[model samples]
Target: MLRSRDDKKTQRQKSEVWPMAKAHVYQRDHINTDEIIPARYLNTDKEAELAKHCMEDLDAGFVKKAKAGDVIVAGDDFGCGSSREHAVWAIRGAKVQTVIARSFARIFYRNAINCGFYLIESADAVDKIKDGDEIEIDYDAGVIKDETSKTKIQFMPLPDFALEIIRDGGLLDHIMKTSA
Candidate 1:
């Protein structure tokens, strides 16, 4: 099948690398899914609607402060609690490019990747990165650079399969591409 020029251009746009993102520091641990997106907002799975309330209970100013390419900096045990996919969806819908944490709840980690959301686990980086710091992440290079502090933190690179899934925009899209 041949794609039109516009279709190819659209595909190219989708594959473009993300730019450096700003960080919003939430230096607390054990931030549960419910806190990320309250149960009251759980009535809908619509990302746009859910995004309006993401982190409202925990940080009332989050929605107002968030920008399309902002990153979330959090402490250990981020996204703990119920296995709700809405938690990740809301964050993505808010246009947050990625999340950096000392650690993440196992289920949340997996769910995040499944939704094509980026998450990095590095205890050292989380502590050093201040609120509203500018940061750049190079997944291929496995480096997280804090522009504000002029420091670099290294994290274990994602496995090849995981990277492939992420690059292709989530597990479902990756699977569909391979299947066809």
Candidate 2:
């Protein structure tokens, strides 16, 4: 059986906007890489393995609780510790592609972009959004809409070049696409 044309139209519309993602709130600031992925678990660079230990030190059940496409809403200095890209990989491997925080460590910010991940810095959004809230982002509009609360928050959109890289799924993919 074929689906209705309306369903196809709806699918196309969803493709234009960011998908609705659940928020996982972490109110504490200065959450370091060590906490995000413990040093003990850094022996391998495998994403799934790393994900198993992501937030193990800080929140032991985070890996078990979080689902793919969920958003992490945290306070200032999120990802403060190591400059390792493993931290970014771990987060992504856990199926969490976006982390909205008050601020992120400079290295972590760069790593996330390089890894084709999203790190949104919005103190106001963090304060307003609670755990388990469903949210959607309008990349072109620079807005985050909380589907649960019917609230909206503005955020600075990534630069064109950065967005391009992220759109291609990392710097390497971007290069490959451009060079092709």
Candidate 3:
């Protein structure tokens, strides 16, 4: 028996999984992009440089505390204000695997995904998760499990096309591949 092409694709997609990570809880609402990366760092689009200043204004120790594969959990409007992609770069550069929030500003959400950053909207998870909590997110399944609280939260799943773009490491890469 031969497997269908779609079935084969599903197997490959399942292999592309995000790792479990620790959570960095920031409970403030309306955390604008300006506060996330700051305008001072916007002079350079270099992710590495921008990452050094990520969340420095809102949480002075964030840069120092953030580790590779850590997740950011925040309250509503986590990414509001200016449509700067710098904020997205900074967060991704910091090696934050996922950002879970109650809500997000439209611009920031698009910029984040375009930059290959994963952002999840889960109000329940935001309210329950605390700093240093262990979290495992299955992006394909749209599920977030908090080990610390033993709670499971679900988010709206992105369409297959959106997931493909993210899997290709952002829109640019996806476009490049498809265009070629």
Candidate 4:
């Protein structure tokens, strides 16, 4: 189980398995969602097109090489810029199941969960993860393990309500399911 300290640490416990596609290392600060998905692609309102241009600034060919179920490990203050839900959409569209970062922008973190995008915070956890490393995220156990390195890290788990939202595929889906 991965254990971490973040604002949402008082949540529930669960575990999930997420495969890695491409890992982006953030060596800088103030990297916002715009840099992750860019505002230019927002015009189309299509996640596929938006995903095609994801992380263009940081990694030019990232979207092209990404596969489904990929998880991203990033540095501090990730998704820090504008509260564009499209950023979360693009990542989800690109098949990125989860994102683990040292820290997340408040709005971005909320938006991600609302969109069923799993976002985790762990500064030290991100340091131990490398590109192409297979990671097992045990939400209930609050543990993260790097299969390749045989290393384990800890992070705080999400709340029960948040976990339910994600399990049902975002807020919209959850609402629709319950409303029926």
TM-scores across all candidates?
A: 0.86, 0.84, 0.84, 0.79
What is the model-wide C-alpha lDDT for candidate 3? Answer: 0.77
> Per-residue lDDT tens digits of candidate 2, residues 48-148?
78878888888998988887677889999999989988888788778774789999998998898877776689989999999999898876687899999
Identify the runs in model 3 with alpha carbons over 4 angstroms from their true place: 1-20
Please tell me which predicted candidate would have the highest TM-score against the true structure. 1
Model 2 local distance difference test score: 0.80
Q: Is candidate 1 or candidate 4 better by lDDT?
A: 1
Task: Determine which window of 10 residues in candidate 1 has minimal summed lDDT.
Answer: 2-11
TM-score quality measure for candidate 2: 0.84
Write down the TM-score for model 4.
Answer: 0.79
Q: Which residue pairs clash in candidate 1?
A: none
* Model 4 alpha-carbon miss at residue 99, Å: 1.1
Once superposed on the true structure, which residue ranges of model 2 sit more than 4 Å away at CA? 1-20, 176-180
TM-score of 1: 0.86
Q: Could you arrange the candidates by lDDT from highest to lowest?
A: 2, 1, 3, 4
Candidate ordering by TM-score (highest first)? 1, 3, 2, 4
lDDT, residue 56, model 4: 78
lDDT of 4: 0.72
